[model samples]
Every structure is written in C-alpha cells, then in structure tokens.
Target: MIPAGFEYHRPADLASAVGLLQEHGEEARVVAGGHSLIPMMKLRMAELGHLVDLQAIGELKGIEIADGTAILGAMTTQHELIEHADLATAIPLLREAALQIADPQVRYLGTVGGNVANGDPGNDMPGLMQCLGARFELYGPAGTRQVAARDFYESAYFTARADDEILTKVTIPVPAAGTGYAYAKQKRKIGDYATAAAAVLVGTASASVAMTNLSDTPVWSEEAGMALANGDIEGCVAAMLAAIDPQEDMRGPIAFKKHVAAVILRRAIDSALSRRA
Candidate 1:
C-alpha cells in the first residue's frame, strides 16, 4: 500500500533535525533504517506531515570506545556492529546479539537506535541494552538528556523519548575484565522475532539478566541478577519467571512462553557462567 504523501526533511546535523521535529510537532517523525516506521506509514497507521530522515546527519553516526565506555551512534547499523573489530572485542555480547536480529539483508539496513528507541517488545536490542545497563542519549530543543535503557520503556510501542527528541547515541560501560556475557534467543525462523530471548552477563561480583518478547516491555529482573550473583540458579529462574507477563499470541499460550523463557534464560545463565574467568 502506498503511504500518504508527506514532506521529507534531511537535516545535516542534530540541531537542525531537532528543530524540524519541534516545528512539525507530532506531524513529524524521524526515520533511521526505515524498518519500523516506514511499514506503519505504508499501512497508514502513521500519518505524517513531515518525515525527517537522519541518514544525512554525520553527528548521529559512529562507533567510539574510550575510557571504559562504548558510545554507539544511533544511526549505526546492525551490520556495522557485527563488522567492527574493536567493538566486537570490547563488547562481544553486542555482536553476538546483533547476529540474532533478523537476517543479513535486514541487518545491513536496521539501525540500533531505531531498534531500541521504538520500544518494540520483539526487538532484541532493548533487553540486551538493559542487561548491559546502557544509557540512551536524546537530543531535543531543550538540549541533551540521558536515560537509562531499563528506564526508557514505559510500555509496548512507547518510550520515554519525547516526540520532539531524537535518540542520538547509546552509551555502555565496558564490562570489567573477564565479565562473561551471552544472548539466548528462541524463534521459529531466522527473520522471526524471538518467541523468547534472554541476555545474561556474569562478572566477578556482578550479574545482570533481562528478557525480551515475554512482556509488554522488556523485563529486566534485578532480583534474578542478584540471585545469579549469589550462585542460585533456581532462585534466579524463579525470580525471572515471576517478573515477566507474557500474553497469549500466535507464538503460544502464556504458559508455553513462560516455560520457553525459563529454559532459554537458564541456558543463557549457564553459558555466561562458563565463559567467565
């Protein structure tokens, strides 16, 4: 289906981009890889007066690792994540998870910013970002503000980012030496969204666990991570099971999703622990 006609804006920098959004208000929407929003627009679910494309903004594209932190530009593609040698070394879990998102063709076009900013439950990056304790940087007319990934999502298809703001980067603290990480996902096919997915990180004295597609929002279980840090796998699993609220879908019944989440999370925990030094 053809989308309703809309004016297109290609801003060369972040400030101009923000200005366009401010001028257009809810009638304007920024697009990165055009994966999510474009489809909605085509279906007329999103009727926009202006479509602000971020592809021209150099300020929103790059990968930088410095001072025990990794800064990923919002426009960075999944293929870029998989291909960067230094990024892969600094955050192996990122590459591991990126590989699981859609297929190669989609990865080449899908942007990390789009994946996390949209608050889609099925997207893989949000849960992984929560497990990594990443921070999202938003640029707006009010200037810049940072939001914790775990605090960003309010519900499915909803996030803390105001319509006037554009997500510009993701900042992640580099895991300490010997921190082990794993992303376990279960899906019917290569391009299918996860029926259930788990991201786990086990450090010398810290642990983090988060799940995807089992709830309206990504489930980041602090209790479950604490249980793992204390070496109680069953406790971790039980806590995670208690946290997720999966609804019945074409995937399966609620009970089946819970069971799959449990099994997948356990596999992730075991895999992460084994990789630890």
Candidate 2:
C-alpha cells in the first residue's frame, strides 16, 4: 500500500533536523531507518504533513568510546555494531543482542536509534539498553538533555522524547572488568519478534535484568537483579514475573508467554553468571 503523500526533508545536521521538527510540530515525524514509521504510514496509522529524515545528518552517525563510556550515534546500524571491533570488545553483549535482531539484511538498515526511541516493546534494544543502564541524549530547540533508558518509555509508542526533540546519541557506561552479559530471546522463527526475551548484565559491583515483549514497555527489574545477585534464582524469577504485565497475542496465550519469559530469563541469568570473570 502506498503511503499518503508527505513533504520530505533531509537535514544535514542535528540542529536543522530539530528545527524542521519544531516547525512542523506534531505534524512532523523524524525518520531514521524508516523500518518502523514507513510501515505505519503505509497502513494509514500515521499521517504526517512532514517527514524529517535524519539520514543526512553526519553528526548522528558513529560510535565513540572514551573515559570508560561508549557513545553510540542514533544512526548507527545493527550491522555496524556487529562489525565494530572495539565495541564488541568493550560490550560483547551488544553484538550478541544485535545479532538476534531481525536478519542480516534488516540489520544493515535498521538504526539503533529507531530500535530504541519508538518505545516498541518488541524491539531488542530497549530492553538491552535498560539492562546496560544507558542514557539517551535528546536535542531540540530547548537545547540538550539526557533521559535514562529506565525512565524513557512511558508506554508503547510513547517515550520521554518530545515530538520536537531528536534522540541524537546513546551513552552507556562501559561494563566494568569481570562483567558478564547475555541476551536470550525465544521466537517462532527468524525475523520474528521475540515471544519472550531477557537481557542480563552481571558485574563485580552490580547486576541488571530486563525483559522484552513482556509488557507495554520494556521491563527493567532491579529487584530481580538484586535477587540474582543474592544467589536466589527462584526469588529473582518471581520478582521478574511480578514486574511484567504480559498480554495475550498471536505468539501465544498469556500463560505461555509467562512461561517462556521465565525459562529464557533463567537461562540468560545462568549463562551470564557462568561467563563472569
């Protein structure tokens, strides 16, 4: 289906993109990879007067690691994350999770910013970002501010980012030495969204656990992480289950999804613990 006609603007920089968004207001939508928005537009679910494309903004594309932190530009593709030698060394869990997102072809086109900014519970990055305790950088007419990944999502398709703000980068503190991480996802087939998934990061000083496709937004269970750290797997699982509000879907019934979430999360936790240095 063809999308409704809309004016397209490719801004050369972040300020211009934010200005376009401000000019168009709620009538404009910023598109990165177009993986999520284009389909909605085609379905007439999203009608916009202006489509501000950020692809031309050179500042919104790259990866940088410094001062024990990694800054990933919003346009960084999954394939780029997988191919980045230093990034993989610094955070192998990112590569592990990126590999599980869609397929090779989609990975080449799907932007990490698109994956996390939209508050789509099924997208892999949000949960992983929560587990990593990442921060999102937003640029707008008001200048810049940061939002913690844990506080970014308010609901499905809703995030802390204002319509006039563009998410420009994601900043994550590098996992400390001896940190271990794993992303476990269960799906019916390749390219399918996870029926249930978990991302876990266990370090010498702290741990984080987050779940995907378990609620309207990604579920970050700090309680569960602490339980796991205290050596109570069952308690951790119970905490995780208590944190999510899974709904019935084509993937399976609510009970089945809960079961899958439990099994996958347990496996991810165990795997991460084993890999801990």
Candidate 3:
C-alpha cells in the first residue's frame, strides 16, 4: 500500500530540520531510514502533512568513538553499525543485536535512531540500549538535551520526542573491564519481531536485564537482575515473571510470553556470564 500524499523536505543541516519541525509541528514527521515509518504511513496509522528527511544531513551518518563512548549518529544504518570495527570491539552487544534486527536488505536501509526513536516495544534495540546504559541526544530549538535510555520511552510506540525535537545521536558508554553482554530473542522467522526477548549485560557483581514485548514499554527488571547477580537463578526467574505483564494477543498468550521471557532471560544470563568466565 502506498502512503498518503505528503510534502517532502530534505534538510541539508540540523538547523533547517529543526526549523522545519518547529514550523510544521505535529503535521510533520521525521524520516530517517523510513523502514518503520513508511509502513505505518501506508497503514494510515501515521499521517503526516510533511516529511522532513534527514538523509541529506551529512553529519548524521557516521560511526565515531571518543571519550570512551560510541557516538552513533541518528542516521547510521544498521548494516553500517554491524560492520563497524570500533563498535564490534568496544560494544559487541550492539553489533550482535544489530545483526539480528532484520534481514540484510532491511538492515541496509534501517537506521538505529529510527528503531529506538520509534519507541516500539517489539524492537530489539531499546532493551539492549537500556542494558548498555545508552544516552539519547535530542536536538531542537532549545539546543541539545541528553536523555538516559531509561527515560526515553514513555510508552509503546511513544517517546519523549517533542513536536519540535529530533533525535540526533545515541551515546553508549564503554563497558567496564570484565563486563559481559548478550541479547536473545524468540522470533517466528527471520526479520520477524520478537515474541519475547531479553538483553543482559553483566559485570562481576551486578547485571542489567531488559525485556521487550512484555508491557506497555520495554521493562528493565532491576530486582531480577540483582537476584541474578547474587547467583539465585530461581529467584531471578521469579522476579522477571513477576515484573512482566504481557498482554494476550495474536503473537502469543500472556502466559506463554511470560514463560518465553524467563527462558530468554536465562539464556541471556548464561551467554553473558560465560564470556566473562
């Protein structure tokens, strides 16, 4: 299905994009890779009078590492991220998660910024970002503001983005020495959304566990992670199940999703801890 008619604007610079968004407000939608937005537009779930394309903005298209953080530009493609050597070495969790995002064709066109900024609970990156303690950089007429990954998503398919703001970059902290990370998801097929998933990053003493498709928003279970860190797998599993409230849907029943989430959490923990051992 073709999307509804919309005025297209390619902004060459950040200022132009922000100005356009400020003027158009809710009537406008930002298009990066368009992998997520275009489908919704075609379904009429998203209607925009104007599309402010960010592809022409050159600064928003590269991978750079500095100050012990991987700064991924909002427009960086998933394929680009998968092949980045620095990211591969410094933050393999992101690289590992990126490879599982979608098929190769979609990965070539899907932007990391679009994935997380869309705030879809089914998307893989949000949970991984939460585990990695990533920071989102929001740019607008008010200048730039940094939002922690934990605070970025307000609900499923909803974000902290204001009418006049754009997400410009994702800043991931360098993991501490001996830290380990893993991401696991149960999908029906390649390129399919996760039925249930877990992303875990563990240090010698603590762990961060984030799950997707189990609630209104991606949920990071601090209590469960603490239990896992204490070497109480049963307690950790119980806590995880208690924290998730997956709804019954065509994807799977709530009980099954909760069960799958627990299984994935166990695998994620094993994968993460094994690397450190």
Candidate 4:
C-alpha cells in the first residue's frame, strides 16, 4: 500500500528540524531511518502532511565514548552499534540486543532512535536501555531536556516527547568494569516481534531487570532487580512475572506469555550473573 501523500522536508540541522515540526505541529512527523515510520504510513496507521527528514544532519550519526558513558546519535543504525568495537566492549548487552532486532535488512536501515523513540512496546531497545539506566537527550522549539530512559515511554506508541521535539541522542552510563548483563528475547521466529523478552544488568551490588512486549510500556521490575541482588533468584523471577499482566492477543495466550516471561527472566538473570564467576 502506498503511504498517504505528504510533503518532505530535509533539514540539515536539529534547530531547523525542530522549527519545521513546530510550524507544522500535529500535521508533521520526523523521519530518521524511515524503516519504522514509512511502513506505518503505508498502512495509513499514520498520516501526516509533512515529514522533517533528519538524514542530512551529519551530527546525528556518530557514537562517542567519554565520561564513562556511550552516547549514540539519533540517526545511528543498529548495524553501526552491532559492529562498533568500542561500544561492543563497553556494553556487550547493547550489542546483543541490537543483534536481536529484526534481521539484517531491517537492522541496516533502522536507527536506534527510531526503534526506541517510536514507543512501540515490542521494540527490544527500550527495556534494555531501562535496565542500563540510560538517558535520553531531547531537543525541541523550547530547548533541550534530559529524560531518564525509564520515564520516556508513556504507553504503546506514546512517549514523553512533545510533537515538536526530536530525540537527539541516547547516553548510556558505561557499566562498571566487571558489570554483567544479558538480553534474552523469545520471538516466534527470526524476524518476528518478541513474544516476551528480558534484559538484565548486574553491577557489584546492584541490579536491574526489564521486560519488553509484556505490557503497554517497557516494564522494568525494580522489585525483581532487588530480589536478584539479594540472591533470591526464584523471588526475582516471581517478582518480575508478578509485575506483568499479560494480554491474550494474537501474539499468544496470557498464561503462555507469563510462562515465557518467567523462563526468559530466569535465563537472563543467569546469563548476567555468569560473568561474575
């Protein structure tokens, strides 16, 4: 299906992009990689009069490691993250999560910003970012504001971002030297959206556990993380599953999803902690 007719505007800078969005207000949308939005537009699930393309903005495509954080530009592709040597070592969990998103073709064109900022409950990156305590840099007609990744997603297809703002970058605090992490996703097939997925990160004495596709927003189980830190593996898994109210949708039955979440949580915890031993 063809996308609804729309005027395209490519801005070479963030300020111009923001201004265009502000001018168009509800009638315009930003396009980064277009892997996610274009498909939705084709289905008419999204319709807009104008598109503010950020591709021409050269600054929004690099990765920087400094001050104990890995900052990724909004236009950075999944392939870039997967192949970056520094990022791969600094946060193997992020690389693992990136590898699990769709297949080669999709990963080549899908930007990390679009994957998470789209606010789709099924995308694998948001929950992973939450588990890692990442931060989002948002820019708009007002100014710039930083938001914790966990607070970014309000619900499926909705976020804290105003219609006029663009997610400029994601900054992940570099994990401690020996920190352990894992991302375990259970999808029905190679390119399928996960049925249930878990991303876990454990520091010396602290931990975090988050789940994707199990709720309206990426679900971070603080209680479960605490349980894991206390060495109560069973309790941690139970707490994580408890936080979820699985829906019986076309994806799977509620009971089955709950079971998958439990199983994946267990594996994710084990994988994350195994690095310590």
Candidate 5:
C-alpha cells in the first residue's frame, strides 16, 4: 500500500516546525530518520496532510557532554550514538544497545528521538533511557518542558508527547564514576525486535533495571531495582516478574516469555554487577 499524498516540509528551526504543526493541526506529522514513520505511512496506519522534516534543524542534531550531563539532539542517529567516542566513554550502555538495534543500514538512518518518542516498546532506547534515568525535552508553542524517561510511556505506541509538541533532545545525568551498565536483548535473529531485553545499571549503593518488549510499555520496576541494590537477586527477579505483562505471540507462550524475562534480567544484573567497581 502507498502512503496518502501529503505535502513535505523542511523546517530549519524549532519555531518553524512548531508553527507548521499549529497551522496544520493533527494532520501534520514530523519525520526524523523516516525509519519508523515511513513504514507506518506506507501501511496507511498513519496518514497526514503535512510531513514536517526535522533534518534541517541544526538545533535538533548534535551531541554534547559536560558538567556531568549528556545532551543528545532528537535527530541524532543510532549510528551517531555508537560512534561518538565521548558518548561511548560516558555512556557505554548506549553504544552497546545501539549496536543491537537492527543492522547497520537501519541504525544509520534511525534517530534516537524517533525510536523513543514513538512509544515503540520493541525499540531499545526507551528501556535503556529509563535505566539511565534520562529525561526527554519537548518543544511546542508554549515552549519547552521535560519529562522523565521512566514516566514518558503511557502504553504501547503511545507516550506523553502532545500533538503540537516535538521532542527536541534527551538529557541524561552522567552516571557516577564506576557505575556498572549492561544491556541484554534476546531475539531470533539480527534486526528482529527483542523477545525480552533488559537494561541494568548497578552503583555502589543503588541499582536500576528496565526491560523492553515485556509489556505494553517498558518495565522499570523500582521494586526490582531496590531488591537488586540490597543483593537479593531472587527478590529482584521476582519483583520484575510481577511487574511485567507480556502477551503470547510469535515469540512464545506467556509462560515462556516470563521465563525468558527472568533469565534475561538475571543475566543483565550479573553482567552489571561484575562491571561495577
């Protein structure tokens, strides 16, 4: 199927992009890397009168790290996440996870913002951001507001972003020195979405755990994380098992998914534990 015909826009600034959305209303959709939206449009799952392209906006593309913080522009590609030496050093979990998100071609064109903003549970970034305790910055006619990554998703393919707002960047507080991080994803093959994936970060006295494709939204169990911090591995896994609600699909039965989620969470926790100094 072909996407319904729509006018294309290239906005060089955030204000211009916002203005386009205000002018066109809900019929306008923003395009970043086009890896996700284009497919939806072709399937006619999404139809719009205006397609606002953010690629021309310099403010929406870049990576900056300083003063114990990292800022990634919405248009930054997955490949950029994997390639930036500074970012790789500051947040190695990002690079590790980005490497597993589809193959090279998709990663080259997939933007971090699109992956997270679209509220796709299968994408790797949302869960990882939750584990990292990152925040997303939104821009619109009213100006900018920030939402914690852990609180962003409302359900599958849905998020806190409003119709008139654009996600401009992601802000992450740099993890304390020597914090351990691991991203573990299991799939049938390369480029396939994770059947169950876990992101874990262990600090000296704290921990964070989040899972992808285990529920309608990313699962970040503060219960699981607290249990891990206290060194009760079983308790942590148990809490996460209780928190997730995976449905039966091509991946496997519900029982099998729960088992896989348990295994993956443990593996991620162990990997992170070993890396923690």
Candidate 6:
C-alpha cells in the first residue's frame, strides 16, 4: 500500500525541522528512520500533510559518553547502538535489547528515538529505557525540556511529547559498576513483536524491572524489583503479573500472555541476579 500524498521537508538543522513542524502544526509529522511511521502511513493509519524529515539534521546524530552518562542522538540507529564499543561496555543491556529488535536489516534502519518516542509497547527500547531510568530530551518552539522514560508514554501512539516537539536525545545514566542486567523476550520469530518481554537491571543502589507488550504502555514494576531484591523470584513474577493487563492479540490469549510474562520475568530476574557483581 502506498502512503497518502504529502509535502516533504528535509531540514538540515534542528531549528529548521522544528520551524517546519511549528508552521505545519498538527498536519505535520517528524520522521526519523521511517521504520514506524512509514508503515502507519502506508496503511493510512497515519496521514500527514507535511512530513518533516530529521535525517538531514546532523546535530541529531551521534553518541556521547561523559560523567557516567551516555547521551544518544535521537537518530542513532539500533545497529549503531548494538555496535558501539563504548555503549556496549557502558550498558550491555542496551546492546542485548537492540540485538533482539527485529532482524539486522531492520536494526540497521530503526532509530532508537522512533522506537521509543512513538509509544509503541512492542518496541524494545521503551521498556529497556524505562528499566535503565533514561530521560528523553524534547525540543520545540517553546524550548527544550526533559521527560523521564518512565513518564513518557501516555498510551499507544501517544506520549508526553507535545505536537510541535521533536525528541532530540536520550540521556541514560550509566548503570553502576557491578550491575546485573538482562533482557528476556518471547517472540514468534525474527522481526516479530514480543509476545512478552522483560528487562531487568540490578545495581548496588537500586533496581528496575520493566515489561514490554504487556499493556498499552511499557509496564515498570518497582514492586517486582523490590521483590527480586528480597530474593523471591516467584514473588517478583507475581508482582509483575499483577501490574499489567495485557490485551489479546496475535501473540496469544490473555491467560497465555500472562503465563509468558511470568516465565520471561522469572528468566530475566534470574539471569540478572547471576550476572550481578
């Protein structure tokens, strides 16, 4: 299926892109990587009169690590995340999660910002970012502001990002040394969305547990993490199950999803615990 006709603007700078979005207002949609939006457009689920392409904005493309934090440009591709030596060293969980997102081809083109900012529960990054306690940087006509990953998603295809705002960066505080992390996903096959997935990080100071494809938004289970810290895997899994109400879909029935969620959560927790330094 072909997307609807639309005026396209490829802006070389963030200001120009934001200006285009500001001028076009609700009729405009900013596109990065096009992995998510293009499909929606082709299906006519999304129709935009003005498409603001962020690809040409060089400022929105790079990885920087400083002062125990890693800041990734919104346009950084999944492949880039998976391949970066510094990022792989700083946050192995991110690379592990990126490797599970679709196939190599899709990873090559799918930007991290597109995956998380769209509020797609099935996308791997959102849940992982939540587990890592990442923050999103949004730029708009008003100015720049930050939102925590845990607070970003409002619903499917809805987020804290305002209509005229563009997600420009993701700021992740590096997991403490000796932290244990795991991302466990149950999917039908390569390139398929997770039936149920879990991302767990256990550090000396804190722990976070997040689930994917289990609800309208990524489910962050603080209680589950606390339970795991108390050395009760079953209690942690139970807490996680109680936190989400997964919808029935091609993945499975409600009961099946719950069971899968339980299994994956258990596996992720156990794996992370074993790796804890």
**In lDDT terms, which candidate is top?**
1
Instruction: Estimate every model's Cα lDDT from 0 to 1.
Output: 0.95, 0.93, 0.88, 0.90, 0.94, 0.92
Question: In model 2, which range of ten residues has the least summed lDDT?
Answer: 15-24
User: What TM-score would every model get versus the actual structure?
Assistant: 0.98, 0.98, 0.97, 0.98, 0.98, 0.98
Q: List residue ranges in candidate 6 displaced over 4 A.
A: none
Write one digit per residue (lDDT tens) for candidate 3, span 1-277: 8878999999899999999988988899899889888989999989899999999999888888888889999999999999989889888888888988879999998998988898888888888888888999999999999999989889888889887888999999888767888989889999888988888888888888898888888888889889888888778888888987899888889878887888888998889888864
RMSD of 1: 0.8
**What's model 4's overall lDDT?**
0.90
lDDT per residue as tens, model 2, 49-160: 9999988898999999999999999999999999999999999999999999999989999999999999898999999999999999998899999999999999998999
- Better-scoring candidate (lDDT), 4 or 5: 5
- Cα lDDT, model 2, residue 66: 94
Report how far residue 192 has shifted in candidate 1, in Å: 1.2
Cα-based RMSD of the predictions, in order? 0.8, 0.8, 1.2, 1.0, 0.9, 1.0
In Å, residue 49's CA in model 5 sits off its true spot by 1.4
Q: List runs of model 2 lying over 4 Å from the truth.
A: none
Q: Considering lDDT, where higher is better, how would the candidates rank from best to worst?
A: 1, 5, 2, 6, 4, 3
Worst 10 residues of 6 by lDDT: 227-236
| Model 3 score (lDDT) | 0.88
Task: Please give the TM-score that candidate 3 achieves against the real structure.
Answer: 0.97
